[model samples]
Target chain A: MNRLSFLAPVALIGALLLIWQGACSILHTPEYLLPAPTAIVLALILNAPILALSAWRTLAMALEALVAASVFAAVLALLVSLSRTLDRAIRPLAVALQVTPVVAIAPLVVIWAGVDHPDRAIVALAAIVAFFPIFSGAVRGLTSADLDLERLFDLYGARPWQRLLRLRLPSALPFIVEGAKVASGLAIIGAVVAEFVAGSGGAEGLAWRILEAGNRLRTAEMFAAILTLALMAAVVHLCFQALEKRALAWWRGR
Target chain B: MTDVVAALLAVEVDYPGRGKALGPFDLALVSGEIVALVGPSGCGKSTALRLLAGLEGPTRGTVRRAAGRGETSVVFQSPTLAPWLSATANVALPLELAGVAKAEARARAVEALARVGLGAAVNARPAQLSGGMAMRASLARALVTSPRLLLLDEPFAALDEITRRALADDLLAIWREARPAIVFVTHNVEEAVYMAGRVIVMTPGPGRSAGETRVEAPTPRPSGFRTTALFRDAAEAISDRLAAATRAAA
Candidate 1:
């Protein structure tokens, strides 16, 4: 049932794209205004080097931001959770960051961090945006443990570190995986949005390249870059999804 | 002539939100003795086992044991096996927790599994186990500790009659070998009569030992013991006492 349900969306997406191209052709839209799927494919193939290079830059920034955010969030959450008063203070702040629009503040983040190191600025913004879910997930996972199991460990006179390693961490793995899955996608989106708002000079991500292509009325080029971003997002998403499944296998086995 | 085996020197428990102390009273769970503590629900039978197992602290008083150096092990009513680990690992949990090396623990866990007649089930996870199988694994785990005291909290209450009898027999075999002072808790009078050398019936509220009955059946009590007149007499007596207590509680 699940396998069949999963395939339904792929079939639907193909049908939707076919209809979109058919409608555009029937309307006789110019290539500059609305490029057919073939035109976008041709542009992507021709400008593969430039587009791929720019995509690499954005991918690199997003990945760096993701690693930094996950590590920082996990560590900070661990430390903050140790103190109840501090957890209470930080939880609301973390939630506020999750709710606030990163898009709205992208230009300000670029201006304040200086446009020269826009990749760094974009990464920092992405880090802030990505950190919250990991922080929340890790904290929830760390805290939710069985009291009976805890007592059983205590009965054995087990050390705190032993209990944490054997029981608490295993229990929290699913939550950690869930947080990372959500964080990875957001990291890529954050980096791309920041690039669009800040506009890179030479080290621009594909987002800025797309804007440049659009401003010059290179619609097919714009579509090609958008296609690359979509592909990258899908790839990152699939990676995290696989990781989440593998990480939670033990829990699911139970 | 012999040293005191297991003694509760004025032990009492009080959890502020949950309930009150069960006893400041005295009792001895002597070596090689199976002392069944029978009581109604929420009468502190479970809590008493927890305290004896050192899973919880007594608000006041002390629980003393005969062993010079050995970990106490418990068999809970529900098999609280780690769902992730296989049955063998679940049975090996005490050894692992005691810092016995993994390969050694697993090897020893195999011996314990064989004793519980779960030799084929050692690799199966808790999810793959039936209620009876899970309980048997828990019994294996408790015995593997080689404790001076083996505390059981109605460990067989959930099993079917056939499996329950088989497990009871296995428990007795383990008890005979290990010779730990077994403090078994249950509400079943027949089980107490069949398993224990002595049965202590507790009064319902804030539970305490209401009466003690001795069962002087010989060693290695056989399968036929359950049908014997002596067993019937012991069970009937305990049942009458329990009925009176329940009536009083009501």
Candidate 2:
């Protein structure tokens, strides 16, 4: 936003980094236990190629999950909206799915999809965990339109598809965008958790990297992968913001 | 076929929410005439207009029409301009929905906007518009169809004195050019007198037609005639009739 606000987070982060380094240096802590900022930076740099490949793989999975989740959510939302009976029948099931821990089902998903393309099962798990909000938010938003606006369409003799395309969809975009913002982070979390289980439930993802680093006492390498996930989250958030602005620029400054 | 032109032969209204019968609304809405339905709030004045527009169904009795949808257009009290649409785009929606090409509909929308003194505000969205500008857009949308019947539900009730009078004048000019059967609703007695050839006083709740008073004003009625004895007389008479109707209903 403004200079002061921008500087605030950076200042806080710099202070935290300084504190971490100072605490480690004073305690004479071993590098493996609490790595210094410089050591973390060096570890990140040295493992660049392998880390980059893993980072790309994770990014691709997040994107794939996001797209699949959104499409599935939209179709389900539309279908539910079109039928009162179906909405009643499916709402409880949806609520249950939303509340159930994806971590609990990670083993089951791995067992079902198996290790042929283990990442595919992980991606599917990620999509399931992230899709509910988009569907529910979109359905609610589309139906929240002022009743008078709908009546006006009828008075003007607009047909069903025309009303949906011109009015309902546009009205739902903001809600859908908000849902996507929330799902972005969750999707990555889902993929990582699924990867963790697939190793136990029996393949590999960034979670494997975190486990490998932890076992080998490579804390900085673990932090590097963690940083990559954080960066991916930030990128996804930025992408949604840019897309929302592009779609709704006409409503800018409202 | 009965050629009883310029009539609403015992129209009635109902809805699930508004459970009871609204009105057995009888009126002699003549051609080339302006009638004002004056009543308290929720008195079925707008409901009568809705029935006439065929937007709502009557529980009993008929809302007789001379012809189908092409014969009428309605202007709601709240402007009702589509918020997501620009002024020209909102006005053009009706024509476009009626199978007109986008360009032709927009052209007519522009012309209607000019008539309502909003020529320069074509690209402005409803959110950017003042109440008067948005109302003008609503009126423009109604007029663009060139219908034989115009249903206005307290169209100027939300405006200040200056804008209301300006809109009244603009509407009268448009009426003269188009010569539609206009049914204007209002709570303001003076406004009813200012705008209409006939003022129909209505009962307050569970409404019915109280009485109708005919004004002998000249065609394309003078906007300044609001200061004249005729206007005062009409307003006072309508007020008396409204009071009487409310008393009778009570």
Candidate 3:
């Protein structure tokens, strides 16, 4: 990005924060109603230990969910690509899982996995939420090889595995990268939503901290937890974006 | 006849919904000969090339092939290089796929790239090369295996005039080495005349052979061959056949 574009968001957010802080002080609004940015920062500092631990847990779960989703999606995508019957058989079920809201299923998952370790349940729910994009992306990538290349492979008498390895998989790499980026964000959202659904189930994640702080009307801490989650999501996105640049260096500048 | 490389004996392809897409057509490739198929769009020139490439089967007739594994290679209209791979790697692919060791394949690939005048761009990705260079890399890949038969389907059509002419000449220069029987397909009448010993004209879709013209000029003609009366007469004969076919279809 250019310098001006990069600075634009920083400038806009700075102005908005100034206005927010000014409005809070001018109106003498209670912290519980809408915590000022300064108050939120202070709360973030004061609860750094608890907040860091919770954030770490949430981030770990999201990462685990992403890896799990990637593996499952890749295997399923390969199976679907291999057989028309398998694709027809599995597609509707995958679509059903995708369309069903994670929030709707989070409670059942938490109860089923046994509330003794709600973290595991949250990760499972998050994986489910993150699964479809990677799966569909993988399926598209596996089949996205150039038609002429397919003909070339056939002419060379490429074995099935050889075709998959040399042509189909490499062709799908960009798609998988994009799908993983989307899945990373969804995985975080899924983790947080699952945490919210499993409130006070002894899960220590940023979402749980938010729920706990809100119960005592510590709105600043709640906002602080949310800010931390937002930061985490942004970092995850930046990581994936960097990865895309590195992994798909050949694909870029085309 | 004993040196016949391959032939389409009354070959026909019928798509499920589209009915006959190609012949009831016949073509035979003799060893070390260059033949071009020229016709209107959708006249099954490409289909004919595909049949020769063994990429498609004839629904109604037999395809006879004497050439065996790695004995045939094709270059399509687009360069169609694997965008993710370096030019050398892309050229090396057919060899590697055919079970040649990676090191040997790569070494030969570099030789092939140099042969096509892309030696400096061996490490460049397909996206990094110019349009003509990419197509040259594709040509190198096709020649890497030294197939007995080379099938080209409108290989230079996407290129500008200068690049097209340069590639056509480069192809001829390379073809002299292996002397593969080449079946070239194109819509460009002059290109068909310039590149092939025989130019076959086809009627419009579900195409049958309209006629064929034999160019008596030698392979890789001298400079200014394009302006020569011999080239003009041969091109005109093919064009006349093409116009007649188009008019008949109309």
Q: Number of the top candidate by DockQ?
A: 3
Tens-digit lDDT string for candidate 1 (B1-250): 2455667766778778877747765577667788899989988788778777766667788888655334577777788887778888877777888889999999899889889889998889888889998898888887787887788889888888888878878888887787887899998888888889899998786777789999999756865898899999999999889888878979
Chain B TM-score per candidate, please.
Answer: 0.93, 0.93, 0.98
The window of 10 residues in a row where model 2 chain B has the poorest summed lDDT is: B1-10
TM-score of 3: 0.97
Give the per-residue lDDT digits (tens) of candidate 1, residues A103-148.
Answer: 8888788888886778778998889888988888898888876666
- The residue ranges of model 3 lying beyond 4 angstroms of the native Cα positions read A1-7, A251-254
Candidate 2 or 1, higher TM-score: 2
lDDT tens per residue, model 3, B121-237? 989999889999999999999999999999999999999999999999999998888899999999899999899999999999998999899999888878999999999999988
Residue A121's lDDT in candidate 2 = 82
Model 2 residue runs over 4 Å out of place are: A200-205, A251-254, B1-18, B243-250
lDDT, model 2: 0.80
Model 1: residue B137 alpha-carbon error in angstroms: 3.3
State the interface C-alpha RMSD of candidate 3. 1.8
Model 3 residue B36 CA deviation (Å) reads 0.6
